[model samples]
Target chain A: MTARRLPSGDFDVEQLTPGVRRPIKLRPWLIFAGVVVVAFFGLIFSRVSLDRSGFELDDLEEQIAIEEARRGDLRVEVARLQDPNRINAIAAEIGLVYPTVRIEIEVPGLDVEGIDPEFRWAQLKAVLTAQP
Target chain B: MVLGVAFVVAWAGIGFRIVRVQGFEADKHAERGEQQRVRTEALTAPRGTIYDRDGVELAVSIDAVTVTANPSHMEDPAAAARLLAPLVGVPKSVLKERFTKPDSQFAYIARRLESAQAQEIRDMVEETEMAGVYFTSEPKRIYPAGDLASQVIGFVRDDDMAGLEGLEWKYDEALAGTPGQQIVERDPYGNPIPQGEFVVDPAQPGADIILTIDREISSAAQQILAQAVKDYNALAGTVLVMDILTGEVLAMVNAPTFDPNDRSDANPEAYRNRAVTDVYEPGSTLKVVTLAAALEEGVVTPSSILKVPGTLEVGDKEYTDVGRTKAKKMSVAEIVAKSSNVGTILIQDLLGNEKHYEYLSAFGLGQVASGDLPGEASGRLENVRDWCDTTCGPSTAIGYRVDVTPLQMASVFSAIANDGVLVEPHVVREVISADGTRQRYEPTERPVVSEETARVMRVLLQGVVESGTGSRALVDLYTVGGKTGTTEKFVPGEGYSEEDRIASFIGIAPIDEPRIVVAIVLDSPSGETEDGSDMRFGGVSAAPVFAAIAEAALHRLGVPPNVR
Candidate 1:
């Protein structure tokens, strides 16, 4: 083995051995600061993803609500058609009568002036035959 | 120095490999990312609506709430199932099985709930504290009038609210609108992105459909039909009302109908719309068509007399009249009143086999009615051109060797009653979409006979109502023109069963001014008067149904009784 000279003028291979010593000094505050930065980034990423997901869910729920409301309206219309009164009213329009009408007639201007000449004309033989 | 050189080479190799991987397979990784995100969602298209001729709502689709679940998120599937069991009436085991499946994300829990029931279910779902439980909106078909013209309106199915039968099925394409889809991108939280470029292609709502049925007449026909069915104690019964003036079907009904709202476990055949679907021997009602041909050809006139017999033999087959003696001479009016089998045969001869069949074809027989239903029968005709020799010629007369639907019979009679105008039978009146765009079904009038012939036929038919077998059909306030039919039921092995019979009647009221024409059928009655509707014989069994419907419908339609 060849002898290696170190910066401190030591010729010992054991002191400079691999995995034995880490000479660089590390400050505890600096380590803490680095860890906080990573954690904050991770938390922000997670919150943004959740917010986006939440907004989508709200929109889907809104669409479902609109559809459900429309379905309810259709059910209501069906119920209306089933109503006995409604059916009866419609029936009346088609000419079905409980007391079935035989017929109804209206004659206008029946009070016209008519000659009562039958009584007088029969005795007088009415008018003479007209000459040319 | 040697080790440092070796380390430098290793570092260069590693750097070169990283560059190759990033550059060469870049597109491959991007494709995988897209595969994981893209999804195709199902777009539900709304089925069409069925309307009465007068624009009354008959069948329509409404949005409805359905309970849905994401099985992966169910915390306590068994517990949730137990709580939901009573209200939904679904087995707890079934629900548990679905929720436990990891791959099954969505499952239908309950379907098309009523508003109050849906609200209650929503409350229960919230109370369950399950993670994946949710609600979905789907289209549910609704029939506004319960049991009104049900056979004509038909019903739909589960899974998809597709029309399974009736006009709902016929106009399905027009009513079923286009469906569009929305693909959603969500994070691990199962939330969809709001503006995820919606990729939205707008869905089109189904077109509206309108029918030509008058609500007033429909209800009246149903009322009369129900009574006759009950009184007869028959297996099944139907009454169809149509406008003679315009071939529009006013009301089409069949009793003992299953409601469309809850249509599970119904008989496959019960769902069969008998008005257009079932065909049977029409008996003597066909005499008019044969007689019309004969009279129109100038082969016979109203004053013409026929020597009727009790039984006449055309071939080896012998036809018996309604017990009228053979060689009994009578006017055409008397022939109809007596319903002589021999007279109809003679009339069929005069009209000739060709002319007689021509008249039948002209009345829309052997042709599927172009209604909304696909299964409508063309009734039964041998195709005159295809007719074989032997007794098949005149045997086709008097409603034998032939078949007809109750609807066909109604339309046929409607022509005679409506001043010779033949109208196509239609069910829907109009269709309206969600945004209120509407489409209407209008009546089509076809002249099948001369007005003189129709008028003369009316007088002859009135005789059948006054003195013939249809005597039981006379309404209190108006004269009725009608005909009775009692055809032997066709049996599989024995050919014709003597014990089983089909009694039917078709009629129109106020003969002086015709309006409605109705046909009623009682399939195999018990001859029992146990019920309020059935009475066996056509007049006894079916005519009363006509009276009830006509009474109510006329009153509703504002048709005045003949008087003053």
Candidate 2:
């Protein structure tokens, strides 16, 4: 250290040589504190997402149950609508009656022998349509 | 010094209480809290559907609602009941009595209400600020076809939906699936808590059933049979239509049937499926077995000559033929066409008792004809060894001393129609499981007689329908064959009823290529037809029913008319 005096009578002190410097070291506690903070926030975020997904799943299950119930109701309604007695009553009200006399039309080459009944009916229909 | 000491004592007491609650009694308190938040709930498995052959629903289970109440929670029980009575279709007085029961915590207001109706009640409760009423989901069994095939389809209990009769009772296990369980944390409003503890074991749904019943044919048969029962003033009636090839029952109609949906005022007797459960003296229907045995044994041909008298004495009993007053030499076919008891008895003597028993057993008599139906009776058949030497053989030969259900008799005719192959009759066609696995019914088949013998028998039956006893069973534009049966109903505690008769007719249509066999049985049909024929006779009353049902069923089956 050196001191300089001037005419103003004030003394100024200055360091003539630089002092020895030390290397900075990272603190373990600080790093650990930072990691803990990130992990805590990550855990909280994941839990929130999981909870949201759970709520969505619950809602989806509830909707599925509701749709299934609706389907069952529709099925029951279809069955009730297809009731033969009700259809018969409706037909009767519309003045429909079974014919007292049935006319048998024999189509040439339309032999239904040995054919499946369902196929025979189809074939008969085709032949009848072709004739008309 | 005293104030300081008191403060210290209070602090010590507080510390001790905190330690005891946090450590010593923690498990009990934790469990109590868990009981409030974590709930174990039961998940209901859906019941199976009953569908007809055409995939039409006969019986179904729908989501319904049941209304219940915590009577103790209601502020004004009388007012709540009055408001709910009209909506629930219950009397206000009854609802009030249920709601006002002293210290009652729970009361059932209504069970199995339709969804729309339940929604209306729920809305009303919410709008009126009702506190006690609650609604929960339940399953309800409904028969959409109304009384059609009611006896065969059956019903379930209102509370739990357990099957009470018919196919429902028979396939209860297959129809009812395994229930599931869950452990879930829920909020105060019973909503599942997000991200809370939840574990679920899923329910397995029931198997679906496909029946052989044709809905259209069944409806027609029911209408016709109901009218016939009314027209003839009979006690009850049964009509069963079966496919000869597959042994699938197309339509089974029982008169006096109760609707399965609402059976509140239905007679208990109406729930009985007489075709499979009740037995009657088969009368001349049994004669087919005798004739088949005779033909199979080579003891008689269709043209074999027989001298038949009006009456034959066997032991202490007498057997006589209807509409025959004198002795006549007739062919075996003619005798069968005439339904002669004396002639059939002679043939039975030719066939012998042991051979007769063999044929009866082969025809599935005295055995439960079907395993698919519940409460089916194996019509009584005495073993040949147990047969009395005096009159057992003779009486059995003439269609006496034997009991048979209508289903059994239908099977008898089906065998002849199916080229003598006796296929076991069944109502269920297939069952489909929740996982789409299918189980189809494979009926048991046995050869009862040779094809040639069956053909001959068919011809003889055709003769009966052509010009003999079953002439009234002829259908328009179809060559049909059938047999007539008339028996004096034997009462259990009394002798044969003088006024009651069991009249029956079993027939096959398009006789050349047989397809369907229809059996009609009428109980105690009295009075006469318009032509003055005795209604008590099977040919007069029951045969006409057979004709109508056969014609309708054939048309529905799309069977081309063969008589042209």
TM-score on alpha carbons, each prediction: 0.76, 0.88
- Candidate 1 chain B: worst 10 consecutive residues by lDDT? B189-198
* lDDT (10s digit) by residue, model 1, range B1-564: 999989998998998877776678768876775556655676787666565655456676766778888777877777877877787888988987877776888888888875567778777777755577777677777777766766677777766766678766776666778887867665455555544434766677777777776665766666666666666667887777776776667777777676676666556566667888889988888888777777777878888987776777766888887555557888888878777777888787777778878888887877765465557888888888887565777677788888888888888888888877778776655667757876665656677788888888888888998898787777766777888887888876888876777888888867789888878888876565544533556766776666666666666667777733
Model 1 TM-score?
0.76
Q: lDDT of all predictions, in order shown? A: 0.73, 0.91
Docking class of 1: incorrect
True contacts kept of 2: 0.70
User: Which number leads on DockQ?
Assistant: 2
Which regions of candidate 1 deviate over 4 angstroms?
A: A1-132, B1-38, B54-56, B91-108, B124-130, B369-371, B383-394, B430-445, B528-536
Q: What is candidate 2's TM-score for chain A?
A: 0.58
How well does candidate 2 reproduce the true complex, by DockQ? 0.49
Deviation in Å, model 1, residue B112 alpha carbon: 3.3
Q: Residues B155-215, candidate 2: write the lDDT tens digits.
A: 8887777888999988988898889999999986678899788999988888899999999
